[model samples]
Target chain A: MKELTIGIDIGGTNTKYGIVDRDGNVVFQGSISTAEYEEFRDYFNGLAIALRKATESIPFAHKIIGVGVGAANGNYYKGTIERATNLKWKGIIPLADMFKEEFGIPAIITNDANAAAVGEMVYGAAKGMKDFVVITLGTGLGSGFVCNGILLNGKHGIAGEVGHTSVNPAGRFCNCGKRGCLETYVSATGIKRTVYKLLADHLEPSELRGISFDNLTTKMITESAVRGDVVALAAFEYTGRILGMKLAETVVHTDPEAIFLFGGLSLAGDLIFKPTIKHMEANLMPLFRGKVKVLPSGLQNQAAPIIGASSLVWNYLDNNKTQLQEEVY
Target chain B: MKELTIGIDIGGTNTKYGIVDRDGNVVFQGSISTAEYEEFRDYFNGLAIALRKATESIPFAHKIIGVGVGAANGNYYKGTIERATNLKWKGIIPLADMFKEEFGIPAIITNDANAAAVGEMVYGAAKGMKDFVVITLGTGLGSGFVCNGILLNGKHGIAGEVGHTSVNPAGRFCNCGKRGCLETYVSATGIKRTVYKLLADHLEPSELRGISFDNLTTKMITESAVRGDVVALAAFEYTGRILGMKLAETVVHTDPEAIFLFGGLSLAGDLIFKPTIKHMEANLMPLFRGKVKVLPSGLQNQAAPIIGASSLVWNYLDNNKTQLQEEVY
Candidate 1:
């Protein structure tokens, strides 16, 4: 029988899953209300039922070889989800073991960013590239680093956390209880924060000045910038500059060949990429300048979540024989 | 015959070599003047003659299995020393190949910091730890990052360069044509800079005030700090705080279990370690705080250079069956 793997993306509100073939095709897919289940066991029970029904309904004869999951604060090494802030589940949860029991197959789990990095490596832009970084610029920035063809899970499976790497000690307050984190200036919400700061600083006539902070959206800013709104353009420039500087700083450590921007703020395209590339080059050491590429994530954003989740299992299957035995990462 | 490896450390003024056993014992060693030989080929030939004579003089009839070298701007992947600022070599020089030709053995070469990191992993503090960073604080700063038990050579073999990562865009002029590099505030010279700045800022009488910039040394500052000199104490504190803050930032990237401080400045002990640990913890993310250890190198400072260079060969021989084949580093 043709083999397929299941990819499950667990978010705060919605939990999405997909049955995917080795070629990145989604054979079947579905979503469930995560917040409605309340209990952790109930949530998995409902998911398993839905997945089972979906598998039975598929027209093609195929076997699910494994399962992969992506969630906030997921630990690849320990296979536990530790105190995920967005999820109602409190404390450390044994998500991976639960996944294996429910699926009756080998299952792997890691943080969404790491999953995205694997997805890029398996079936997207970073194919055949061992050294690259995936930066997810969503509500909060997330990062996954791939060094020498292995995901950098670190000693405690918490190594690739560039989002929390503070850009400024006294710049801005972040939700993670840290001051001036990179995400505070570079995420989708980070761009919005910059827009408001620009608005408050300048009485310059602009479309964004009319919108209140609550109603202000990154989409509106993008649209405004596309239409040549000075404030919106400046916001993108400021955000890119901050991101570029951090990328330059991070480059010296990980030394990735390419850095993929993969979320809502990234949709701004050249508006974000141009200034970020400019500042990053300006700040980089002489040896690294003109060498590193800042590119868009190859995976389509709408399907990226489930695709990333499933790629973990595929990666596990591919490298399990050698990587698992030798590296222990 | 018993197996052994030769380790060579190439400096601007002197070239040091050691015939070391697998257990970190130096059975024979010697030094030659590097600058006296105007040509690179002649220098290697002269050094090879000295090594051969030293090998014959040794009482034990051990066979040299391989050679490892450490130098400024050494590239591990390419096996070349490229445009080293301190050395007279004008461009990329194939040091490893030359070593192999001269010694009739397999050879390896890496930057001094990376060699030191491998030395720690093979015979020093990080013997069993898979993830660690070694920061060398001498005339300038140097760094080697080992993530997931493999040295991060990056895409271009220049990845582990935390010393050049700018702490401030406008802080201080670095010899590398960069501004505000971490080395400017954390090396032996960095402490001296801090001392002079403190003396200039404070009217408080200092023993250092009478000394010229060229006359004052890090040893005098260390002695003064030991004797409870306020200005000297303040300089160490300032230096440590800067180093600590950079360490906190760096920890998020490679996520080392321990960071070993080596070379001249690291000799100051608690004067550097205490404030560095304090500021690093303070600036760290909630997860990493109190988790990372800042320690001194396990090797004696005087012998560390030769030992670090030589350990590369032993590490190669030990892991050649597995690590070198798989990782290709």
Candidate 2:
């Protein structure tokens, strides 16, 4: 029988899952509305149903050996989601335990960014690379660091919170009650924030001036930038400049060979890539200048999260081979 | 027969060396003036003679297994010192190869800070910890990062250059032509600079005002602070505040369990430690708050560099056990 794993990505709005084989092929997939289930029990029940339906439909149902979950604030060490602000659950939810009980398989959990980093390592751009960083640029910036070929799950399994690292102590205010966080100036919302600031600061005429903050999106800005809109181009440049400086600072901590960009904003392609690379090189210490590569995630956009989630199982098994073998027998 | 290793620490002014046993005990020690040799060949010859003389006097000379070197700008991978500004040599000096050729033993090299980190891991405070950072606060700031119990040597073998990381983009001018680097605000010279700035900014009664910038030292500032001089107190407070903030930012990157402070400035003790810990906790993200400890290095002042250098050989042997075993046989 072909071995497979069930990968689940739990987001605020939707929960995505798929039956993925060892080769990263998605045999079957499904989704459920996450916000509809206000209670943790209801969410778990819904997840169980979705997972079963996806797996049962596949021809190789018994081949599924394990389950892996990727979620916001997921703790790999504890297998719990601790006070995730976006979720309706108020306290720690033992999601991994629920999955293990429901599926009768080894289950593992980690934060989405770490899952993404594992995905890159197991099946994407960071293949065979021991030291690298993965930055997920969505509504907020998320990061996962791989050092010496292991995920840097520091003392508390929250090591790669690069987005929260302050770039300017007195700069922009962040949702996390801190000022000058890297995320406030580098995410998709960050780009939108930059566009609004640019529109307010400079009177330069451009297509982005009329869009209000609530209606504006990074995608629209990218389209405008492609069309040669001055304000949109400037927004990307500013965002990239801050990101580059932050990455340069990160480089001194753990000299990553490459920093891979993942998630929605990365789709902007060269609009974001060009300026980020330029500033990263400019801000780098002389020894690291032109040495580190800024690249895009190798996984497809929609499937990247699921793939990342799936990789957690393989990683867990690899690290716990002796215990896993005993349990299997 | 007991096993021993020769540890060499090459600084701008003096080169310190010692023969150390497996238990971190120094059997014999000596020093040579580095400035006396302008030519690399002359320096190597002098170093060979010094090593011979030091080992010949020791009772168990045949028991020495290997040699380790710690120097400014030392590259672990290349075993060379590249363009060290303080040294007379202008280009890459193959120091490790020279030691290997002269002594016919396994030799290794790494920067002093990295050596110090390994020393802490093998024989100091970080004995059981898998993740920690060692900050050496001397004339300049030097950092060694240990993640998952391995020293973080990036792709170029020059990771953990935390001193160069910018805290404030426009804060202070650094010797490396960068503005607002952490070293510019946190090192021995950094405190001295802070004292001068404080003198110019405040009209408070301070004995420091009488001293020129070149004459003022961190030691003198500490002495003045001990005497309840307001300016000196404020300088320490300011320096601690900036260091705390930078460390908090560093926490989000690798999430070290504890940050160990070593070198000259660390002698100020609670004068620097108290404020730094307070601000580090205050600036930390809620998840990391009260989680990471700010502590002092375990090694004594005079022996830290030599011990750190010695650790390089042990680390090298551990990592290259198969090759080392083959060579030994």
Candidate 3:
């Protein structure tokens, strides 16, 4: 029978899951509304049933070997999600253990960014690369750094919080109660904030001036910028500049070969990529100048989170096999 | 017979060398004036003669198994010192190859900060700890980071340049042509700059006001601060605050278990340590607030460099031995 792993990505509103083979092919895929279940137990029960139904629908012969999950504030060592502000669950949830109990298989969990990093390493842009970084630019900026082929989870399994790294001490206030966090200026929400700031700062004529703060979206900003709106274009430029500078600081820490940009904000193409690359290069040290590449995620955008989550199982199994071989020898 | 490693620390002004055993003991020590030699060849000749003399003076049974060097801008991968502004040498110098040719032994070279980190891991503060950072504060700030017991050299063997990470975009002009680098506000020179800035900003009556820019020293500031000089005390506070904030940012990226402070400036004890620790704790994320320790180096101030350099050989041998055992089994 063909071996397979179940990969699940838990977001605030929805949960995505897929049965994936070693080659990163999804045999069966499904989704469930996470918000519909108010209690943790109810959510787990629904997820378990959904996973079973999805597995039963797969046509090919397969043995489910393991399960992997990706979520906000997921702790790899503890197999729990702790105090995720966006999630409906209020406290620590033993989601990995719940998955194992339901599927009777080995299971692992890590933060979404780390899952993306592992996915990139296993089957996406970072394949065969020992050192690299993956930056997810969705609602906030999240990062996963890999060095010497091992993911840098640090001591607490929460090492890659690049978004919280302060860029400006006196700049914008972040949700974390800090000033000038990289996330406050670089994410999808950050771009919207920047657009409003530009609208207020610049007196130049622009199409986005009439848009209310509550109604304005990153998509609207991107569209306006593409249509030659000066304020919208400037917002992207400012966002990219901040992101690039922050990345330059990151380079001094781990010295990755490449930094891959992923998620919603990254899809804006050259609007974000061009200025980010330019500012990153401009801020790099003399030894690092022109040495590192800034690229986009190679994984299919829609499937990236699930694929990334699934890679954890493959990684865990590979490590265990190596350890077992070492012990036997 | 005791196995010995030749450890060399090449500084801009002087070169320190010692014969060290696996136990991290210095059997014999000596130094040579780096500035006395006009050419690279001349310096190498002097170093070789000094090393031979130092070895002969050791009245014990020993076999010299390997050699390790720590220098400014040293490259572990290339075994060369490249573009070291502080050094008299203009371009790349194959110092490791030269050492090998002179001693007929395996030789390796890495930058000074990395050397200090290895030193701490093998014999000093980070012994038995897998995840930690060593910040060496002298004329400038230098850092070496270890994750999972392996040093983070990155792709170019020049990662962990924490000193160059910008704390302020428009704060101060750095020698690297960058604006507002952490080193510009936290190092020995940085403290002096801060004192000058404070003197200019606040009209506080103090001894430091009389001292000219060229005449001021970190020692003078420390002595003045200890004697209850307001301007001098404020300088340390400002420096510590900046250092702490930068370290807090570093934690988000690497999530180190502890950060060890080393070098001449660290000797000020509570003057720098108190404020630094206070600010570091205040700025840390909720998850990492009390988890990370900021402490002083465990190595003796004088012997740390040589011991750290010697550790490279031991680490290399241990890794190779493990690899060999795996292959044989």
Top-scoring candidate (DockQ): 2
- Over the stretch A140-201, how does candidate 3's per-residue lDDT look in tens digits? 78899998889888988888999888877788988777788899999988998998888788
Instruction: Give the per-residue lDDT digits (tens) of candidate 2, residues B1-329.
Output: 76788999888889999998777888889999999998989988998899999988778535778888877778888989988756888888888788778877877888888999999988899999999999988777889999888888888888888899987777898866788889988999899989988888889999998899988888899999999999999999998998998899899898889999998788898999999999998887777788899999998568778888898778767888888666654
Q: Rank by TM-score, descending? A: 2, 3, 1
TM-score of each: 0.94, 0.97, 0.95
Model 2 regions more than 4 Å off: none
Model 1, span A1-329: residue lDDT tens = 78788898887789999888899998888899988987888988899899899889665666777778888788888899887766888888898788667766767888888999999999899999989999988778889999999988888887777888878899789877789999899998899899888888998899887898889888899999999999999999999999999999889887789999998889889999999999999998877889889999999667788999998977887877665324222
Residue pairs with backbone overlap in model 3: none
Which ranges of candidate 3 are over 4 A from the true structure? A59-61, A210-215, A322-329, B59-61, B209-215, B322-329
Tell me the tens digit of each residue's lDDT in model 3 across B103-189: 777787998899999999998978999889999888778899998789888988888889889887787988777888888998888
The TM-score leader among the candidates is: 2
> How much DockQ does model 1 earn?
0.74
Q: Count residue pairs with overlapping backbones in model 2.
A: 0
- Quote the lDDT for A246 in model 1: 90
Residue pairs that clash (backbone atoms under 3 angstroms), model 1: none
Q: Please give fnat for model 1.
A: 0.68
